[model samples]
Target: MPSLVPHLAAVIFVSALAACGEPSSQAAKAGPPPRPVLVKTVAYADRVTERSLVGTIRPRVETDLGFRVAGKVARRLVGVGDVVRGGQQLASLDEVDLGLQTEQAEAEARAAAASLRQAEADLVRTESLTSKGYSASASLDRQQAVTEEARGRLLRAERAMTLARNARSYAVLTADADGVVTATSIEPGQVVTAGQAAIRLARTNEKEAVVSIPESLLSLAKGRAAMTLWSNPGTRYEAKLREFAPSADPATRTYLARFSIPAADETVQIGMTATVTIAVPDRERVARLPLSALFNQGTGPAVWTVGTEGRPTLKPVDVAAYEAVEVLIGSGVEDGDRVVALGVSKLDPGQIVRVIEALQF
Candidate 1:
């Protein structure tokens, strides 16, 4: 009798449970609800892609400031990065020698003037003597020649004096325009030659971003660009294409371009790294869809769009570009169409599909 009643009762309960589960299992196998498939909506927009480039913040106009006259550097008033105004003194040469030369020239000029006056006086007296028969006509002619020679000497001396003054002025190196000193090549004791580049100044009037653009992205040089500094990326400056190299650089094979930033501030200094972005627009209207959504029905690449009838249809599209995971469709798909992204091959053209919204956590 050893618990036979309990065993029999357990067997009956198990049988009842199995009988109830068989119908449910059959119903599940028969498809209680259609499975939800991954889908993407089609919405074509005007194509505009952005390209970012690395470059330097450069002045639109840069000049190498040099001394017009040669001399030992006496005092450099402004150094690298110093702000200088137009005609502002940048450095001064040792003026001792230059000043002495100027004084000597002045003295010579004054002496020549006196000599000319004396020569004229002699000529006048010589003419008077010749008229009174005290001097010969040849003597008067000689005096006249002497006066002309003196006058010529005076003119030469005056010109030399002017030149000496100009040379003295050149001793003090000054800025030709308002700019910042970007480089310095001389020390106080260094002797520099005339027209030797001593300092490099970059004009702050119009700042530009200079970048070497690759040949594939040459269209960026013509497009309206924008810039941002690496030092401060949050701020942005609008820019326009100011200069584009007609040919590519020999080494890098990239086109040199300069985008003028008329609104650049102090933060955009010379040599600072910057990023230029070009938003190049395309005339073709396109929409992006996952690559898996593309299907080949022997005619061309196509995507499965679930129409209002909840039926799948193969719609052919022109592939504008093929990317890693997405394809740009140029045409053949209207906006607001639901495209099947995954398991597109399982769906049949005649099969009526139930649209189930995807549950996202």
Candidate 2:
């Protein structure tokens, strides 16, 4: 047992020396430090001359369908989404009261006509009697006055008959043009006043997109066709300036612009969001960049550009406009120069970085 202890001791001593001879424990624990991230230069794409805006899909011409005479809505011949043609009946007002009034007027007119004929006959008899020296001049004058009164009454009755006929015709609501019913405000048994909107019909041929243009850009939008880029790409539509509000909105200071679309797709429905673009002439060239590229320059506007050495360099910029997710660079950036689209605020001058193409917005 004593001999075995000596041999174990020698073995332990040798192992410790061998481990020390190989390397220090601290030295072996450490590994190489991480390598610096790489950055690359990219040539920017040329910016296009297209301008854009936000707009709404609307009918080119919307006609309100209403009754000319006030009455209870007896029958609604058409409802919302129904297509109607010119002269098509859309609704009817209760004609009972109108019919009664018309009948009364007709009766009055007939009575007046009868009275006029009787007066004329009496006048002729009196004239014959006066010529034969059987009637006095004063009696003849009285007969003439009666005839004039009857003629005046007849004329008034004729006018009343004409008015009654017009009122009756107004009970039937008809479409002035071919269109689809966009809204229905009245139902059966509901009373509507004259000229009240019962239905809103939109003309099928004349479709339009209404856009509120910023007053600042109104000068640029003049003489330009407002275009619509449909939600589905590859579908494009355009319209001329149909109308524009002469006054600016008090709240937003924007002008209302209506553009007429000659033909619209069947799938195009009202109230859908449409992107509008109007060209502006004689405007300065703008370099559009992702909003992320904008950086804070202390207090004023600023941006970060990827310098020739692929390093972030802060630059002060004047912005013409800030749109959806992009910034229109009025100054401080060239069209074909690359700018740090994102992570610009986190970068510093002379610091290297790694830029990758963004796949998602």
Candidate number of the best lDDT: 1
Candidate 1 C-alpha lDDT tens digits along 100-195? 999999999999999999999999999999999998899999999999999999999999999999999999988889999988888898999999
Q: Which pairs in model 1 have colliding backbones?
A: none
Instruction: Quote each prediction's TM-score.
Output: 0.72, 0.63
Model 1 segments beyond 4 Å from truth? 1-50, 129-135, 279-285, 288-314, 322-327, 335-361
Model 2: residue 329 alpha-carbon error in angstroms: 14
Task: Compose the digit string of candidate 2's lDDT tens values, residues 153-185.
Answer: 999999998999899989999999998899999
CA error at residue 185 for candidate 1, angstroms: 1.8
The prediction achieving the highest TM-score against the true structure is 1
Clashing residue pairs found in predicted model 2: none
Over all chains combined, what TM-score does candidate 2 have? 0.63
